[model samples]
Target: MSEPSLQHPLTGKRILVTQADAFMGPVLCEVLEEQGATVIASREDIADPDAPRRIVDQAGSVDILVANLAVPAPSSRVGDVSAGEWRDTFATMVDPLPRLMQAVLPGMREQGHGRVLVMGSASALRGMKRASTYSAARGAQMAWTQSVGVELAPENIQVNLIAQNFVDNPTYFPPEIQENPRFQERLKREVPLGRLVSAREDAQFAAYLCSDAASCFVGQVFPVCGGWVNR
Candidate 1:
């Protein structure tokens, strides 16, 4: 195990954060930079099959890959889920995992140390109404992380995931939704924390996972949803 710096554990580390404009991408990049890491933020639309590889190629080598992939979750019930919607959801969230891994793994292997963190959703960890398509895609991400995390562990590349929900992000719980009384009641009733996990809090945890101190963690699905998954 390496002794990581307390204040700047990510110093000297070059990290690539995908979908830099959405989901947890913005905050993750901000916190990682504050931790002294060189963040290669990519805002590329990865729906095109070649985009993931292109993004990686453009960024060159990186010590970490933060797959911050997301889309506006579809709210169709299970019976109403259309094939196009299902495929699009997976295209955005699930398909890019392997593509990004394929692009980045070789460099990581050469370096003999790397980290991959997927900013996923707790909707996959727990059941949600009208979220079948989204949850299925997120579930695939978690399973892929578990499998690849172990496979790459021996090579010193740690792969893990943060299954998060009820986090303060513009995508899911924007200010307008947060200010609603009904949503506030739902938060109090459903979430054990009685509030959305702040963006900084979630980003800080992500920083830890990307740090040298987190090398031992592999194939782990860490829930950062204000205890919503457990409850």
Candidate 2:
């Protein structure tokens, strides 16, 4: 069957997406633009101290903010993890998310409308053997997203988390993980669909959640796991 044409229910809206250089980020930007929304794509690493200011300077008025940058954790046991490694992982995966949201919240409040999509991982729901730090950070992100969503609901600024499964995008998976045969077999066996989720599929859902159609969904962690969690 021919694919359906991309359509945006949020046409004419202004959207800002961080980590635009990432695979999913660009896909989202293109989809939003095709749907009639004015998209401001930023390649900023939100973990950087100066990133928030740079994004604000570039996208003057952001009606939607998608925080989608994450640093992969180095494989190590809890006891063997170094202090610097822990700090770096926390900064990249946990910090900056709230800071970025704070930068855009005032303007959204003024307009009485906004949508914040925070990308998390399915690993947060299920523990991975060597990914303790990464899982913890994602769990924290989901909790933070919920709190912010509740706080901003009165102002019509909805915040939600997308807990993604093993998406079949190079950017989503670290090269080292992809190179591991045992991990690959585990993923194939665990995921009910027997395959990785597609970037386009996740992007499509994100586009909808950021639209008026999903106005009622707030502070919720929506899973796009392809039945991985169930197994």
Candidate 3:
């Protein structure tokens, strides 16, 4: 089948997307390019020690910044979690968002206009059983994005988040979980949509959030959950 086209409202804009090789990231890139936006792709693991420098080198100034890198926590009861696991999860999902935001803000402020979209999960809305770390980190990201949005609004920069639901992207589900029929059945029952959200749909929402049309949508955690969170 032919690849789907990206129709973006970001014409002539410069967009920087982190974790470009990941499923949603590439789709977003394609869409932005289709809309005439110049996209610079970066794959620095945001949790890595040199992530800031790496991202800066690849992206000097951007009209839009999409922070889309995250590490999903393993599903386990709270009592069964280990320190290292918790640290790793936080490193990817929570810690680096602020740092990356700092790195991008100076240029954005100088320009007096910018758009920032931080990717989050619908899991943050309702805590899932055996997903303590994931819930905590995603929740933190949502809050931080809102705080930044408020702080940056006076400068004409918009900051928001997309609290996505059960997307069908491969990265959304770990291999073992995808291979488990029992778990899959349970997921089907839990999501009222009766299926997972598509990556393209999520990407399209993201692209819109980064466009001029979303200028008034600051500090909001918009859901693209396909009715999952509403239930």
Candidate 4:
């Protein structure tokens, strides 16, 4: 194994991070910057139809695109899933991905190399209660990634995803839940790692994957759920 160092393989790389104010954006930006990357943080929600293209257009010559998309996890039962809910979830998570890729591909193709990493969810990997819409949307992201990864591999542009759950973040495991003893017990009983994966751990992994060192990984769904979704 290689010795650990503070310097990241992404040193000097120009990376564009989407949804920069939410989800895993802040931490991802922090870690990527710490590793010497010049991060272009886009605070746009990306729900607007033309936002993806505009964002990519705004950031020209990007070496990496971190599609860090996120929305509130829907708790409506599969039977109670409404058309509006389904459409909205897909709109929030799935639709923008292709647009973003298409917009950025030309520049990456020009450069002859690039990386696209999707910040996704583990709920898509397994059946979860009352998360049908959210899981389906996330699954769509992964499925699109799988097809695109192979398509872009010839251009030396890597597309991949990090399907994660049960991590220490403000979105899912908020302060109130973390303070609950029951939640802590459940965390220990459920996750094999026996705790929430730190934000830095997850962010660092993302940084490495976006780096040149992770070129071998393509269209791969790496679970960062601390063994929560072992399958």
Clashes of each: 0, 0, 0, 0
Better of 1 and 4 by lDDT: 1
For model 4, what is the C-alpha lDDT against the true structure? Answer: 0.88
lDDT of 2 at 158: 92
lDDT of 1 by residue, 28-143 (tens): 99999999899999999988899999999999989999999999999998999999999998999999999999999999999888899999988887788999999999999999
**Which ten-residue region of model 4 has the weakest summed lDDT?**
1-10
Candidate 2 pairs with clashing backbones: none
Model 4 agreement with the true structure over 156-231: per-residue lDDT tens digits: 9899999998878777888998999999998888888888899999999999898777899888898888776244
Scored by lDDT, the top model is 1
What TM-score do all the candidates reach, one by one? 0.96, 0.90, 0.89, 0.94
Candidate 2 residue-wise lDDT at 188 = 74
Q: How many backbone clashes are present in model 4?
A: 0
Sort by lDDT, best first: what order?
1, 4, 2, 3
RMSD of each: 2.1, 4.0, 4.2, 3.2
- Worst 10-residue stretch by lDDT in candidate 1? 1-10
**Relative to the unseen true structure, what is the C-alpha lDDT of residue 94 in candidate 1, on a scale of 0 to 100?**
95
**What's the CA error at residue 97 for candidate 1, in Å?**
0.4
Scored by TM-score, the top model is 1
List model 3 lDDT by residue over 21-131, tens digit each.
764777888877877788999877778957966696568878888888677558979998889888998887788777777788888888889988887787888867999
Per-residue lDDT value at 141 in model 1: 96
